[model samples]
Target: MNELNGYDIEDLEVGMTASFSKTITEADIILFAGASGDNNAIHINEDFARTTPFGGRIAHGFLTASTISAAIANRLPGPGTIYIAQEMRFVGPVRPGDTVTARVTVKQLTRERSRAVLLTICSVGDKVVVEGEATVRTTSRARREATV
Candidate 1:
């Protein structure tokens, strides 16, 4: 890890991997709804959600997908990473009490290691709930040293 508690551009390798996990909770859903203004009934109302194909209340796709953010921001390229873009597909529902494990793998790196493409995946046990890709920029030790 670099002084920033993250990977410096030069520290990254194309196959590096890391993960983070969190269990969805009622409070998490409510808080997400309040914070994001995404109060869709399927995510916040059990009865309304039951009528949908999901069968019961489900966490917001973005809320559940937040695990992927956590994985990227706290692991792998870590703290100094700046996301450039992301693409995601929500394939399954995550309910309250489901533990979501998000994994990130380094897919590609620029020659200078200043940019990276990562594969992101989140699962509840064996069921994949989210799959995606992300591009990010990282701090460069050479650049930082040059400024000093």
Candidate 2:
């Protein structure tokens, strides 16, 4: 959505937050499984997954986390931001048809390095599915330059 404009490194402030929501789908799981080479049956085979504690096939954990990345790249810091590192903890499972919301809040910023540390989270309704921290190297004035 063009509603969000990328913020320069200097413009970011602690407590600034952004979010995006997506509905998990079977195709999403299948595509992510192929792209990530994670052929784990728990994510692809419902019959096999039904035997597990999760009760049915679950989406790849990284797929859920990628929603958080999408929020960062498209919403908060917006474009021209490069992911430096991320630490994630998968606390719950996401199933097809579930609506997941990804949120990122700026926790710290280093102006000299143009880096920001953010608290990232993904949830299905009130239950947290994933939580973590991400560090990004952001560009100052890159959005303006790209438009020109």
Residue 129 miss distance in model 2 (angstroms): 0.6
Model 2 agreement with the true structure over 1-148: per-residue lDDT tens digits: 2334477787899999999999999899999999999999999998999999999999999999899989999988888789999999999999998999999999999987889999999999999999999999887665457688
Worst 10 residues of 2 by lDDT: 1-10
lDDT (CA) for every model shown? 0.91, 0.90
| Shift of residue 135 alpha carbon in model 2, Å | 0.4
Clashing pairs in 2: none
Deviating ranges (above 4 Å) for candidate 1: 3-5
Q: lDDT winner among the candidates?
A: 1
TM-score of 1: 0.96
Total clashing pairs in model 1: 0
- lDDT tens digits, residue span 57-113, model 1: 999999988888898888878998888999999999999999999999999999474
State TM-scores per candidate.
0.96, 0.91
